[model samples]
Structures are given as C-alpha cells and as structure tokens.
Target: MTEPVKLYVYDLSNGMARQMSRQLTGRQIDGIWHTSVVVFGRETFYGQGISTTLPGRSHHGAPLQVIDLGETAIDEETFNEYVMEMKDHYTADKYHLLEFNCNSFTNDVIGFLTGGSIPDYIKDLPTDFLSTPFGAALRPTIDAMYRRPSPSEPTPPIPSPIPAANATPDSQLAASILQAVAAHTQASNSTPNAATQTLYAPIHAITNPPSFHSFLKSHRAAVAFFTAANCGPCRMIEPVFERLSEEKGVKADGTGAGFAKIDIGVGLGNSLASEWGIRATPTFIFFLDGKKLDEMKGADANELRSQVDLLLFQAYPPHPHTSLSLPAVQALSLNPILFTQVPAIDTVLTRLSSFIDSNPWLSTTQSPGQAKQTLTGTVAPYLKARFSAAPSSKLPSATPTLLTSWSQATSAIASALPVASLFPLVDLWRLALLDPSVGTWVSSFPTSSPILLFIDKATAALKIPDPTSNPRNYLLTVLRLLSNTFATPALARSLFLTTRAALAEVVIPSLLHTDGAVRTAAASLAFNVAAFLQKGRVDKVKGGGGHAARDNTLEDEDWEVEMVSAVVEALGRETTSEEVVHRLAASLAFLLRLSPAYDTQLSPLLDVLQTRAVLKRKLTKGGCGEDGVVKKDVRKLVEEVANKLCP
Candidate 1:
C-alpha cells in the first residue's frame, strides 16, 4: 500500500527574520526556511545528523506550512534502506548553513518518495542569503560559528594504526575473492539454475478472477497449482511447489515467472478452479503471457520441474555463452580491486599545506585571508574535525564547504603550480574518493567535472616527452585515485560506461610503468574494469538482463582486445612484485570469464599472445622473488588461470 508523503516547512526565524531582515541585511527575507519530510508516521530531518520521530514531535515545535506531496508507492523497507544510504552523505559535520542543510535533506527525501521538491522559497533561501552584500560579509563569521567544537562534544580518541604502504591488504581482498569464488562454484554445481536464482516473490494464493488475471498479466510466465485439502498426492508435493515459487518466481525487478496456488474448496470457493476446468485435485496449469500454455494432472515433482524449465525457456532463451564448459573462467572471482586504505587526515593536510606554502606563486595566488579561509580555515578544519568523534562514531561526510573549497583549490593549483607539484593535492584527492559520498557527488555530474578534469590533466602529464620530468608520486597517486573510483560501484559503472576509452589510455600505459607500485595500482584499476564487464556478462547469462542494464554495459568491442593485450604484456614483464602479477592474472581471468565472444575474440587473443607460456615462466622462474607465502598465493592464482584457462 502507498503512504502519504508530506513536506513540513518550518520558519527557523520564528517571525524574527521578517521583522528585522531589512535592518540587519538590507534585504526583506520573509522567512528562514527549514524543512522535513513526514511520511509513514514519522517526521525526518537532518541537523546534528539525520533524525526521525513521531510526526510533529521534533524540536521544531510546529511547521509554518504542511504541503501534501501526494502518495508514495515506495514501501517502508526500501525507504529505510535509502535513508541508511543518505546517512553516509548527510552526516552532521557535513551540514552547511548556506549550502547543505535541513532543506537539502528534505529535498532529497521528497525526491526519493514522490519525485517532487519543496517550494522554491525554502530551497533558495541559502542562495538568496549568500547573494546579498551584508550576507556575504557575515559568511566567514557564520562558518566559524558552526566549525567551532561544541562544549558537549566528546574528546576524540587516537586512531588505530594504518597498515604500512608495503603491506598487502590480503585480509579484506582475500576474503572477498574467496567468498565470490565459493558462491560461483556452489551455483555452478547446483542441480538446476533455479536453485541459485534470487528468491523475490512468494507463492501467491488465488482469490477472485480479477486478481488472478492481474497476477497472470504481470508475470512473464505463471503456474496455478490446484489442490484439495485431503488429497494425499497434493500434500506430498506441496513443499516442492513452494520451493519452486521462491526460486523461479517473479524477481525483485518485476520480471521472471510467477507462482500461484488454488484450493477447490477454500480459494474463491471453487470459482477460479471451476473456470479453469480443473476437475483433478492435483492439477497443474501453466501460463505464458496471461494465456494457458499446457497442463499436467499429477503431483510428479520431476514433471513439474521440467514444465517450469520449459516455461522459462519459452520466456527467456538461454545465452549461447552458457553452453560453454569453461570451469576455470566460471569459478573466477568478480569482486573489483579497490584501494580503501586511508592515510592520516592530519598528515595529508600537513603535506598539502607545506606544498602550498613553499611555492611563492602558489602562496601569493590567493590573498592571505582567502588562503586561510579556504585552505587553513575551511579545508583543514573540516578534515580534522570530521574525525574528532568518539571511537564508535561513524565517519563524517564531506561538507558542501569542503567540496567548494577543494574545487576552488584545484582550479587555483592548476593555474599557479606545474603538473609535477600536484602530488600533494592528488594524494588528498585520492583519499577523498574513498568517501562514498564524494564518489556519489562526483558521479552525479553528467559531463566532465572537477574529478574527471583532474584525471584528464594527470593523464596528459603522463604523456609528456620527458619521462624524467614525470614525478613517480604523481603517477602512483593518480592510479590509486582511479582504483578508488570503484569503491562506489555506481561511480565505477558510470566511469566505464561513459569514459572507457579515456580510462584505457591511463591504465594501459601505467601497467608497463617502471615502478612496481605504479604497475600494481594500474593493475588494480584494470581489474576493476574487467570485473565490471564480467558482472554484466554474468547477469546476462543469468537471464535477468534487462534493456536498461544492458545499456550500461561497454558496447565497444575493441576494448576487450586492448585490455587483454595489455594484461598479457604486463604479466610477462612483471617479474618482481607478486602483488602486480596476482592482480594482472585476476584481470585476465575476469576478462575471459563467460565472455560472449570467447570463441572469436578472447580465446584467439590469448593464444596469439602466448599467455600460457608467459604465466608458466612466472611459475618456473620464481620471478616474484621467492617471497614464500605471497609467492605461493600468487602462484596458485596464476596456475588457476594458466592451467584451467589457457590449457
């Protein structure tokens, strides 16, 4: 059932702003607007973080206006999931008086629920306030007021030690890869594909003809299980039918087959059963596109299963790739390589400041006051104060001021400093991308934004004629930033779906970089891209592929060939770092795994590149340098690809 969604608009000034606005700011601002969403018996708002309570129960006593936003078809469970995700983006420290504040949260929620926004006056108040001369004069003072630590705020505890740069993040990466491999293996070994499909809809009970027909009309295929209470065969096969419903029934995306049950005596008082001409107690009638296809009058479980498979086959023809016997590729993990390690925020900021202060051009580009306000005052304070919470508190989202400050800083750095001096700023940007909120904001832009522009500039720097002029720190930091883009899957998908060619330019060359760290980071980025393609292929093979999902897939056929060639070449050259070899091997595995053109493209490409010989040399030469445990792990991963994939 749909729930009524309402907007609760409160005047934060309580009539004072309208009375004194002309005297204070020389602008007649009628109200200081704050808004919250009221839905499902709760009033939700964001301030010192997001809070929800009974309607009309928040600290803001009464709303100045209650706007009916119509009904929301969004269910409670899905809505709650959305709120949890929003928390990561709308943390308390992220609140900005003139930017991201109470009304911003309400606007987001209202959009999620009803696809509508609050009144212009409420949303535009911040922009209006900041535009005035008097308001602009007070902006810094206002920012300082909120940036001040609250007296009641608890002292922050010392953060746990971060892992050394040389240490591999084997625990997190290994666990994820092993888990994916285990699931894929189990699914492949399952008897029927239905056993592995996600369970979404349950076995619906037949009611009146209208409801019954509605169910049939909605699903691609459906089955009506007719039974009587006392029939022995019906009782025996009931559980089997239910199990089938959950596995092969309508999926969450509203596709796939459906299941319904009917009893002659109980359901619709034999109305549906009589209309369908069901005389037998244990009858099964199959449907496709709201019309009866076939029927069977028995409780034979095997026959029922066969009929369900037939229904699905008629609905969605199997992909040709599914017929291949590629056990090695099938068992490969699909988890993308991610760089989630965070450096100390204070240390990062310190290095950034030193870089800025040392350069005369950079130091004087902005006035001392502007420099302090944007960098020292706003940027530094925001990063440090974000972590000044109790140990158990969640990390804060990047504030609107921080985003604005960082963007301005990037623009300033581009003009005042050369490409080589960008390592400090690039390092900070790399760490910032780990924050999912930052990733979300970055992806929301439909065209080239700050982050993308930064990447393009960095990539251009890599292509300069003088190799010695390229700073290794800049290259490694940029590669790491590219890897962290996959930390948020949506951002990763968008990047690949929109800018695969540009990404290929960056990743392909860095794979062959002289520095092992740069090569390792580049391999991780390549692994993420390959993993994304593998996921799309797996989804298509699983029969859940929709037109929209397919649209997000990489359509350029040349990309697969380019990526495969690069990985093969890099793996052959990477003789020292076991980490680089491991990532490159995994990248190759994902690229070749369940590929639609395995016969025509990837298989022939691997053969021509002599990938088997290259991997075999790594195993025989001990090129990863006899680093015992790591060497063994890398060997095992390489062997999985060499023996199973290449052989």
Candidate 2:
C-alpha cells in the first residue's frame, strides 16, 4: 500500500489559538498555530523542532486538520538516513520564531522525498504575519525573545546527542546542502553504466498500443514488462526488471534497453497488455523495430535477465574492424569546391581588427611569431606562391615536395604566429588536398613519414588554451579540412590498410570536450572516420557506455564504435547551447549511415534529448506541423539524425 503523508496543524497557544488571527485578518480562525507532517506505513512520522513522533500521533499536536502530501519511493534505510539528515539540520536552537521554523522544514523534507512540495499558502504564512500591524508591533519583541535568546533569557532545551559519532550539526545550511548534492552524485555513480538516474530513461507506463507503437517505431529496441499491483510474482520480479533497466549493455551512452512497465490491473494497461496477448503476471517482452523478438513469463529473474541481455547484444552486436578494406572506398574522390580558394580570408582578417597584431599568437607563445606578419602580409606570400605554382593535376606526385615545404612552414609559423593566425595557411593546404590526385599521394605516406610527425605537433595545439581566440571555431575550420580531405571512400578506407593510431587517439578525446563547436567538429570527424570502417554491414542493437558489459564483441576492437559511444555519453551530459545539438545530430546521422547497428547506441540519447530543457526545446518547439521543418538548432538536428538512425 502507498503510504499517506499527512500534514498536522497545531496551536502553540492554549485559549488564544483560535483568536490570534483577529489581529491580522480581523476574523476568527481555528486552532492552527504550528504544523508538522506524518507519514504512515513506514512506521515513522517527521516534523520540525527537536522532537519525534512514534508512527502516529505527535506529542506536540492534537491537530486542527491534516492535509495529505503524497507517497514516497524512498525505502526504510534511505528514509531513516534522510530523517537523521533533516533532524541534524532542524536543531531546536537553530529554529527561529519566524525564519527557520516548522513550515520551512516541512517544505524541505517533502521536496527531497518526492519532487512534490507543500502548498505555497502554508509556506507564505510567516511573511503574511509580518506584514500585519499587530505582527509588526510585536515582531521586535518576538525576535529578541525567540531569535537565539538574549544573554539573560532562558534557552530552549537541547535534544540529547545522537548515538552516532561525528554527529555535530553543520553550522551552515550550505554544508548540509553540499552533502545532499554529494549524496546524489554518489547514488548516480553507484549503478555503473546503468540509466540509474532518479528519473528513468526511456521508461514509460504505456496505456495504449497506438502511442506505445509510435515510440517503438522511433527507437531501435524496447523491453516491456507486463505486471500488476496485486500479483506477488510481479512484485518479486520488479527488482530484476529495475536492475536491467539500470545496467548498460551495448555502448556507454547510459542506456541498457528501452524499459517500460504496464500494469494489467490498471484501466489502460489492461487493454494494452491484453492486446499483446499477455495473460500472466511479470511477462517480459523484447521488441526491435516494432517486432517482438522474445518474451518471458513467471518470476524467473535469471532467465528474464538473460533473455533481455541476449536480445540487447543480438540486436546490435559490435562488428569491430581492425582495418577498413572496401573497393568503393578506394574509388572515392573530392568535390571541385574544395579546390577553389577562399576569397574572404582578407575580409575576415580586416574585421578581426588590431587584436591579431596585438596578440600575435592567439594561444601559444612558444614561437617568436615574426613569420605570421610575413604569411598574413600581402608582400611576401611563401605558401600561396608554391601552392599556385604546383599544378592541381600533378598534385599526387608533387605532394611530397609540398609536404616538405608545409612541414617547415608549419613549424616556422607555429612558433612565430598565433594558433588562430595559421587559418590562412591551413585553409589553403586543405584546398590543395581537394585534388582527386592526392588520394594516391596521401596513402603513400610511410610510418616514417615526416608528415605524420607534423600531425603530432598540430595535435598538441588542441590542448593549448586561447582565452581570446575561439579555439573551437578555429578547430572547427581545421577539422572540416581534414574531414573533407578524407571524404573520398578510398582515402577513408586507408585506416584499415595502415597504422594511423596517432590521429585516432587525438581525435577521440576531442569528442568529449565541453565546447559545442569542438564536439561538433570532433563528431564530424567521427562520421568521416566511421565511413572508412563499417565495411558495408548494417544491424541494430542497444547498449550503455562503460568499461564492463562487453557483449558479443570479437577480437578486433571497433575504435570507431568506442568513439561514437563516447559521443553518445557526451551528448547526454551536455547542458548548454543549441549549436552542439546541431553538430551532434549531424554526427549521429552520419554514424547511422556508417552502421545501422548504432541505433542501439544512439537510442537512449533520445530520452536525454527529450528531458533536458536545452535540448528538449529544440524538439518541442515550432510553429510548423508534424510534417513541417524545425529550425537548424542542435536538438532539431538531433531529431533529423534520429530519423536517419532508426529509419
């Protein structure tokens, strides 16, 4: 049975309890003077002040009336710990006649237990009291008498110390608040890789098939458990169901499987379960793409868990590729647009003003930066001359010489110019690589190639801080250059044929950065890299991201899969900005194209996208209809990507 949380109103004064309101409202009110809450079924009641209630009636109150708050999901042990936590904060000596009293305590406890809070009318009583003429007249005296007690006044009796050691009340409420926050953090970390948030992810109580079916169609996999309140077997298996809901299986995006429960005893739940032909209590069903994959009945916890686990893996198993080898990849080419020089570089520079000259090196001071003026200046353009002089058709054969020059120029400019100032040089080099001929030239680099060495030097700059410069923006420009260069199937497939672990290592961590632009760039890079690795296999499955729970994974680790997993998790943690959602969505769509199996990995993020306000608004808003398009916000982009992933 659900416990009833009752609010007990009380009268502090004997005869004047009913008459006290005459001063304020000029009307007769009841005996209500003070208040506390009582929770039955837990065999415990709670209130403010240094006192306790033994399950039922309180020593302080007969009561004017009782108002039911709501039920709590907190178990006995956890509730008791919270009770003690509240008691320590509500020490009698700390209670003020107006400020820190029973009402404030009640609001805090009720809010913590359930997300619900006590009525605002009850909470506003103190402020209302102080606003009256009688209250104003007596307030100073009341303060002197009750607020910490004057030196000569008698003190309230202190409660006996708790039996536990280190039981001193935190002097500051902020300390208790901090402890509460830490406890929440500890709880979230307790269930590793599981969607153990207080708010369940992808878990809904469905009442009808049309609604449920729509959700099923949108996601890669879903697990529904048919249960009833009165069924003992259902009760027994509920823990197992909840555990699986929390455990992650496929990748580290904080999703195990789509989890939901429907009680057949309830009105809507009954029809839905009956429609599915579920006649037993605790019937567990696994679904993929709106089709039933497996089901389990009775209270056999192990079998139920195993079945779901199996489906989770089978639905989206890892197909790791140590190296990519695809004929389509080898036959790839680049767009003609990349070969065209950006004519707006000087315009952008002129707009940036004197800041560039003032801070020659945006983020790095390791180099002298004299070469920046020469490179950015119009008089002596070393890079432009060489790039223009070299024929675009002969680029494949000519790249080594260009690479040698690029390496020296990069080193010289890196030391002499701000990281931001290298945009022109990096930009033109990217444009040069757009020539279809470079595919042969790029793949020709040996492990001993100096070009690989320059890659390391460039990567180190990723970690450098540039407060004035938009590092993410600059990195975005660089990443686009790299992704475009490898957009061709042949060049992307080169990952499998060679050892380029250095580039992958640097790229993966960038996906986890807090900057939306950086993450967007990183995600774009992942999509480009993923195209090189899928090897033409596409399947769907579900997973959560963590070190454990390796399901159906073979010997060859899919480094691309792991990187995508990190992206899924990062998207879950991201809280700010719309642009990130745009880039992240773009990345997800690309990953989906890379492999249909990522639907399992990308599915749980939908829950996050729906719940978080920053991301949610992107999905919910729009004057446009169901068929209408949304703005180019991150969440909107994510929705588009979701369609691509599941479709």
lDDT for predicted candidate 1 compared with the true structure: 0.69
Report how far off residue 488 is in candidate 1 (Å).
Answer: 1.4
For each candidate, what is the lDDT?
A: 0.69, 0.50
TM-score of 2: 0.33
Q: Could you give candidate 1's per-residue lDDT for residues 1-647 as a string of tens digits? A: 89999988776665666766676567898877778899888998877667888887776777888999899998988788777766754665555455446776676677667766677777667557756665655454334323424458542321112224533443233223323322321232232111111134455544335446655755678998888778999999989997777567654334557777766665242778879998887999999888999999988998898788778766754444454455555565777666656567677657766666676664444553464457666666555555444423667788655776667667676566566667767766676777777788778753424567667876897898788887788778888888888888788888887788889888898999888888988998888888888787766645432212354355565888898899999998887887788788889888776565666787888899899988877776465566422555566778778876773
Q: Which stretches of candidate 1 lie over 4 Å from their true place?
A: 1-333, 360-372, 385-392, 446-449, 543-549, 626-633
User: Candidate 2 residues 457-485, lDDT tens each?
Assistant: 45766666763444554455566566655
Alpha-carbon TM-score of each model against the true structure: 0.52, 0.33
Off by over 4 Å in 2: 1-399, 411-421, 446-455, 464-474, 495-520, 534-558, 569-583, 590-618, 622-647
